[model samples]
Target: MSWLPNADIALLKKRAVIIQKMRRFFIQRDLLEVETPSLSQAGVTDQHLFCFKTHFVGPEISERKPDPLGVPLYLQTSPEFHMKRLLSAGSGSIFQIAKAFRNEESGRYHNPEFTLLEWYRVGFDHFQLMDEMEQLLKLVLACDNATRLTYQQAFQLHLDVDPLSASLEQLKVAGASLDLGDVLDNEDDKDTVLQLLFCVAIEPVIANDAPCFVYNFPASQAALARISKDDNRVAERFEVYYKGIELANGFHELSDSKEQRLRFEKDNRLRQKNNLPQMPIDHRFVDSLDSLPDCSGVALGIDRLIMLATGQSHIDNVVSFTIKGA
Candidate 1:
């Protein structure tokens, strides 16, 4: 029947076991488990992230005359803002395994709706968090070792170009050599070119024998991570990849209220430029920065992690249902 789940009944059982082990891993470390609302009035303004919008209807539409379409709500792309609010209110060291929603994300490693394992460490930086992440993965996936590389190092080793200083033209040439697709002559931005080349030319080469952590991304690509003090040109961010699949993203949290606001504004401007819908900035989250402790946080895709652990190739093989199946 078309209504049946995509994953076999046996695979579903294995997925449950993985989740159980993950919970135990965090519990032993004394990280408090918490939950936040999946819907919000405000959403992330990141240009690259798209939110699914919905409307609420009251029992009687005419009774509420001021707004007839009810409050426009967004299915949260991540639980980051609400979790950060809790951190601001002094809920130290929290974690959640929650459902997250996104728009325009689907395929081998993505789904419009998926489970996310997000956690925050009160006093840890990106490096310390990476260590914790490694431990968690090792325990859950039964892995022993992981490889580490800087963004520049990964580029140099794989694509043989200095990522930070490479001109747009150089990246275009590299992309052309890879034969991924046409690199239009009009494209001039460094970040855009670098990202395209990284995904096509470099990402596929990451070793599958061990997990990989690519750290210290260029400053421009940092979403919420703080700029590294050691190197102003790079952000204190890292991503985990297993078997050529990106499994998680971690950040040395940026706590500056002004900078956070500026970033949101910049994201909105980019959204406008690209003819994408601009989102409302989460001002409350920005306000909470004053109370948020020095911390590091990460969001991991539960489905992808399970896929890696279970030796599944397609993301749909591990999940009970995919969007199309549902």
Candidate 2:
């Protein structure tokens, strides 16, 4: 068996250069660089995400009768909760290039442990954030001005269906042509079906050369984004796609503590319904939401950006080590 880094020297050098450039780009924009804890007492409750759990042993923890294993700590899937806490604490406009972990399938585009470039811009809405994202893409990838579309428009343009107003039956009918097999038939959740349709039918066919920004996702898929004031049916969320890869996800953040908690509970309920593991909600993070500033935040996949920058096809080609190599 061979033991070597997945990335060669040239690829490693290119990766370093890209990171340095990213730092410079953010620094010039006056966003403060900050670091948050990678391990937390609670994990994300999102049904779509899973956390890597580890045990924390204190000097006296092992002797406790109630628990045989030390306190369970979870490796954060994203630094979002911690960063938002910082924002709540009055840290204005911060950014982080940090390691994030997720327990999931790892392959061409995904790594269990990967670098993420996340930032929050105070007082900016989703549109303003999208504009800044375009500028950054121009600087880093040297791409042309991206075409913009609402989530509804993207679906209509590509699949000739109205995602925002479509009934569950209508969406299922639209998705039927994809021949996605039992996946579509078995899914009862409208949001799940819409997400699958977006991934399978739309993502591959989007602009392959320049970036594309799809905004105003359905409220059901809002996650942490605020629902649109003008239209309650959708949220102020946006996602950036470039070279047929999803590069960034951003939101005009929701600052309601109560609403946030309800969302978390909803996610756990969904997890229970699906027989997936229920994650402990980070109460500390939720509590901080009341003080969180009106801002926009986004998390960009650094490894994928590096892959696009260096003309690499697989994630492993841009990182020093793959999961197997590690």
Candidate 3:
């Protein structure tokens, strides 16, 4: 029946065990577990992410006229901003398994509402974060080995192109060769084309066998990651993939407030160009960046991880219910 949960009883029990093991893994590392609000006054400006909007009404009814429309709020897409604020306020090494909301996202590997396991490790860069992430995956997937590749290397090995030096025309040609179909339009950005090509051509080849950590993405794709000192064209970012499924995204947190503000403004500009709603910038989060320690953080998809662990083909199989089922 439509009222039934998507997951069976045994699957739900296994899900609970996975969650428990995850908590124990973090607790053993002394990473304090904390909870942050799932709703906020402002939402992320990232052009690719969309936040669900809502209104918060006051409890008082007999009092003076409360704004009938109520105060506008947004459901958080990630707990990253709030957690970073806590880190700036001197809360070192924290982790959270929280509910994150994203508008217009649902598929075999995605859901509008999903559980995220996010954490920060002070004094750790992207490499260190990857090591810790690998350890966590080992415990969950019961795997001992993982492959490592840089963004450049993966592209080179899989697609026979240099991701950094390749021109837009070259990328378009590569995409055409792969039969990706109409990858180039006058309006398409370079990074967008690269991503399209990467997804179809490169991603599967890298992690098809074992869990793989692909690091050092192009600087343009870096959301909050610091640019690499060794190579200005790359950012200190890494993503974890298992069996052709992307499971985690991590960054060496950027601490420069000015740069952070510039990135947010740039995101809004892109949003405006794409005719998407420009989100209100989180000024508090920007201010917190000034004091944010040199740390690394990651957001891992709980459902996708469970899908991989249990050999489930669809995300709905691991979760209790999909949004429609719920």
Candidate 4:
């Protein structure tokens, strides 16, 4: 018998249909479909996300015939890093649907590996990208009226606090008062604290309703998005939520190489503080950043999108095969 439940075959067909429609949507818009290497020499400097590691062996490097230096590589958690590299090289607008992996994550909502749909729009701001995200969600669901909300508003409506402005102490207090789960060990880090609050307070509410976009994230938490000028306190970033599942993340691309370096260095510092191994910085990416166009980009989980579209609650239902069962 197939690992996937026979009933899910219908859902699988729907997933294929949506994926086909997505390619058509971008094609009609004149966006080029691109591919990037999955086995990369470096990793995202973000200290929180963990990636699965592998070793590359080749005779070319060490003349060992089959193996040399046991070259270390990682399964990409997202195609963002590589896709942005393309943008820096003047690829006007691009999109890709690819497989991504994350280590040490397994749950009803997570698998060690999953499908990712990512795209970039040149000469667009984050808000413009938000509008595009709405269109994409509507297209996938084949329905209109999907909801949208800012991060602050989502928190205020659900957690009763302004996440962007909340003090760490205030966040801790809020967490305790609400019987929210345990605080992150590094709650002093505002980004970490904000994430905790969002998970504890905002997530349940966002998940309970129709799909929504959590927009305008804190600047400190902006991994690769440009910081918002008006607020200086937040970055132009957003994540789409549906049926309690996070479906997509979008950013107004950060084009400054120096800033990107600063962020990468900061992330490395964080890794040292946490005793995690440091990853090599991708200098090629930094070089490209200098010439990178102003763009808005987003990544969607095709499987999760399928889950919502077909009303299948668990991620396993949409996947052809899952790690645990595989």
Candidate 4 lDDT over 202-259, as tens digits, reads 7767745567778888888888889998899889999887766777888998889899
Estimate the TM-score of every prediction: 0.95, 0.97, 0.95, 0.91
* lDDT digits (tens) for residues 1-326 of candidate 1: 99999899998999999899999989999999999999987888987788998777645422224345776778999999999999999999999999999999999888899999999999999999999999999988888688899999999888778988888777676567776554645666678788777787767777478898999999998888999998988999999988788889999999999999998999889889889989988888999987889999999999999998888988999888899988
| Cα lDDT computed for each candidate against the true fold | 0.88, 0.91, 0.90, 0.80
Q: Identify the leading candidate in terms of lDDT.
A: 2
Off by over 4 Å in 4: 1-7, 60-69, 181-186, 207-209
What would the per-residue lDDT of candidate 3 be over residues 144-202, giving only the tens digit for each residue?
Answer: 57889999998888777898999988878767777655545553688888888888887
Best by TM-score: 2
Question: What's model 3's TM-score?
Answer: 0.95
How well does candidate 4 match the true structure in TM-score terms?
0.91
Tens-digit lDDT string for candidate 2 (160-259): 8999888888888998889999989888899999999999988887858689999999999999999999999999999999888999999999999999
User: Where is the poorest 10-residue window by lDDT in model 2?
Assistant: 59-68
- TM-score, candidate 2, is 0.97
Alpha-carbon deviation at 26 in model 3, angstroms: 0.7
Q: What is the RMSD, in Å, between candidate 3 and the native fold over all Cα? A: 2.8
Model 3 has an lDDT value of 0.90
lDDT of 1 at 319: 85
